[model samples]
Target: METEDMNTDRVRHVLTSLMILSFLIFGGLSAIILITDTPLTTSSVSLPFAFLFVSAMTLIVTGQIDERPKLTKKYLRQWILVCVFMVLVAALAFTLA
Candidate 1:
């Protein structure tokens, strides 16, 4: 049980880190866009928003799972999904660019 709790904590930590990274990236990009007055219609402009969306989803999932005990499997599942989402978003961004 202790090990499961530790694993849950680790998962939470990683997701929280990712959320922070997403926020940083989004904020930096948004600042750049605003400073340059870049048009939102550009394909690359969506990348930051996509990352922000993923982080929001991550936050929601983390909050939901925090209320449950012995949900290590669910944590792993959520981690995998979030990773896949970030990868997909990156791939889309590259393809669009």
Candidate 2:
């Protein structure tokens, strides 16, 4: 029942999901490193946090917001808070590093 355009869109979605998964893996590894003996540098933590946040935002834009109304302003406000929180957390991570 699906057409060529549907298949292309599915492939794009799958590709984006793979990219996002990789970012999440990296972020989780960074967290694990921070928790373990070596500890994580400011950049170490920042890089992962930034990547994860960006990946999530991009997925939201590409899969939902631009094409649908799956998100709300209140949710967006919370997401912004999450971004700000990452900055503050990174700063603390730096001091601890």
Candidate 3:
């Protein structure tokens, strides 16, 4: 049915979002670690928030993909929150370190 297809698409979207998140989180962190020989500090805390933003942006982007109604708002708000949190973390990290 059409509903089933839509549901499947939504699931696919969420999965893709998660995959993208992992890339930004694990991959970015690994790269950062390799580049900088330093232990994690508050400065690194915003990294996860950035990852969330990237993943949310990915969902919004990529040529108009279908979104589930329930997830749409959740993801949007999460992105916003992450952005704000990242900003705070970056500031604190720099000052503290």
Candidate 4:
């Protein structure tokens, strides 16, 4: 169906954007850490939080662009659950680190 195709296309676009944004953000942070002589462990600690923040923002923006409100809301809710899991994992990592 055309609606399904449109949803798939939008999801692909969102994923592509998420990947690019993740790379840029993580790459920049790594570079900064390298330059400042910060420990690799610090980056390890921050990585999850960075991903959580980035993905949430990306999803919010993507949801706004979606013409179907119900679908967007559903997607956003799923992403929120994912982000919460990421945060829990991040917290565990932080404690273990």
Candidate 5:
């Protein structure tokens, strides 16, 4: 039972870290878009790169919080989905502005 609880806690921590990282990625991209006169394609193309970098950094930072957890496929999938969602939101914000 304790092992199960620990697994759950680890999952929660990973998810929370991912969520915060996603927000940071979105905010960073939005700031760049808003501040610069870059073309939309350039900004859009940069989102994935930013996501990759920030996600890696998030994992590194969060890993220190607990035993370094192996990133399972489930976590990878969730992070990808979050990245896609954040990119869509950033694009929409730029479009609407």
Candidate 6:
């Protein structure tokens, strides 16, 4: 039981670390886009915004899982859906760009 708990802790730590890194990167990109003088277009700004959204969602999921470690699977499923949404957003951005 102790080992299982430790493993889950480690997994959660790794997940949160990755999410933080992604959030920083995506947030930076979004900030850069917003800071620019160029006019914002759907194609020009959608991908970074989408990434920022997904990163935020993942952070939320990580928090939920941290509160109830047993719900890891449920949060993971949500993470997968968020990833799919990211891909779709990327495709749409490309099409529009």
Name the candidate that leads on lDDT.
Answer: 6
Assess candidate 1 and give its lDDT.
0.76
Q: What is candidate 4's lDDT per residue for 1-97, written digit by digit as tens?
A: 7897777577759666875787677677677767888766843646745664766566565656466644765766766676677767777776777
Which of 1 and 5 is the better model by TM-score? 1
Error of 3 at 72 (Å): 2.5
Q: All candidates: CA RMSD in angstroms?
A: 2.4, 7.3, 7.0, 6.7, 8.8, 2.2
Model 5, residue 75: what's the lDDT?
Answer: 54
Q: Clashes in each model (backbone N, CA, C under 3 Å)? A: 0, 0, 0, 0, 0, 0
Across residues 51-97, which tens digit of lDDT does each residue of candidate 6 receive?
66766777787788789888777888888897887869777886878
Which stretch of 10 consecutive residues in model 5 shows the poorest summed lDDT? 64-73
lDDT of model number 4: 0.66
Q: Write the per-residue lDDT of candidate 3 for residues 13-90, one digit (tens) a residue.
A: 775767576566857776776688767665564565456555655555322335354454465566557656765775
- lDDT of all predictions, in order shown? 0.76, 0.60, 0.60, 0.66, 0.61, 0.77
> Model 4: which ten-residue window has the lowest total lDDT?
61-70
* Residue 11 in model 3: lDDT: 59
**Candidate 5 lDDT, tens digit per residue, 1-97?**
6785687577657666785876687677777866885666744645645565556645644454345345444455665676567667656654665
Model 4 collision count: 0
Query: What TM-score would every model get versus the actual structure?
Result: 0.77, 0.42, 0.38, 0.54, 0.46, 0.76
Model 3 TM: 0.38
Of the two candidates 1 and 4, the one with more favorable TM-score, higher being better, is 1
lDDT of 2 by residue, 1-97 (tens): 3574565466457647855784877678776776785555575666576667656754654554335333434444565586677757866776676
Best TM-score among the predictions, by candidate number: 1
